[model samples]
Target: MADGETIARERIERLESLAREAVAADEEDRARSYVRRARRVAERHRLRLPRSFERSTCDACDTYLRYGYNARSRTQSGHVVVTCDCGAQSRYPYE
Candidate 1:
């Protein structure tokens, strides 16, 4: 049997893929809804998202971010900054 964290991670992965597909199909609202659901799953299971997905989600509104669309990215001082449509900003350092 899978542990709580494992199950949550699987759900998050599935949701993220679905969100991406929705975005590719130009269904922005549907993608956002999927992202919101994924965030709730993570919260309920007390699990943190993987690093790759972490940068693709908005912390404030739980919306999935697509660069050059609903999200913007900029690099400064060795860090990549992501700004979401909901006015949430996240920074990650890259080497």
Candidate 2:
């Protein structure tokens, strides 16, 4: 079980890195696919994604958020608002 968890964690990290690279390369579709795969791995393994990967992904549509591209970000009322291309919104508070 520990070894399985380790493999799952490694796969999640690889997927997240690939997603980021795909987004940087302007491949939104590929990025989204990577995000979906990461999510599936997490769910299957009953593992939680790291905070950074969670922040970079959209919960509603399973889309990877590329700042200023598929997603727009703004600070409003002491929270950061991220709006995804699929019309889903996520908010995070800053200190």
For all predictions, the C-alpha RMSD in Å is: 1.8, 1.4
Candidate 2 RMSD computed on C-alpha atoms after optimal superposition onto the true structure? 1.4
Query: Candidate 2 regions off by >4 Å?
Result: none
- lDDT score for candidate 2 against the true structure: 0.92
Local accuracy of candidate 2 as per-residue lDDT tens digits, 24-74: 998878988999999999999999999999999999987778787788999
Please tell me which predicted candidate would have the highest TM-score against the true structure. 2
What are the clash counts of all predictions, listed in order?
0, 0
Alpha carbon lDDT of each predicted model = 0.86, 0.92
**List of clashing residue pairs for candidate 1:** none
Clash-forming residue pairs, model 2: none
State how far residue 82 of model 2 sits from its true place (Å).
Answer: 0.7
State how far residue 51 of model 1 sits from its true place (Å): 1.4
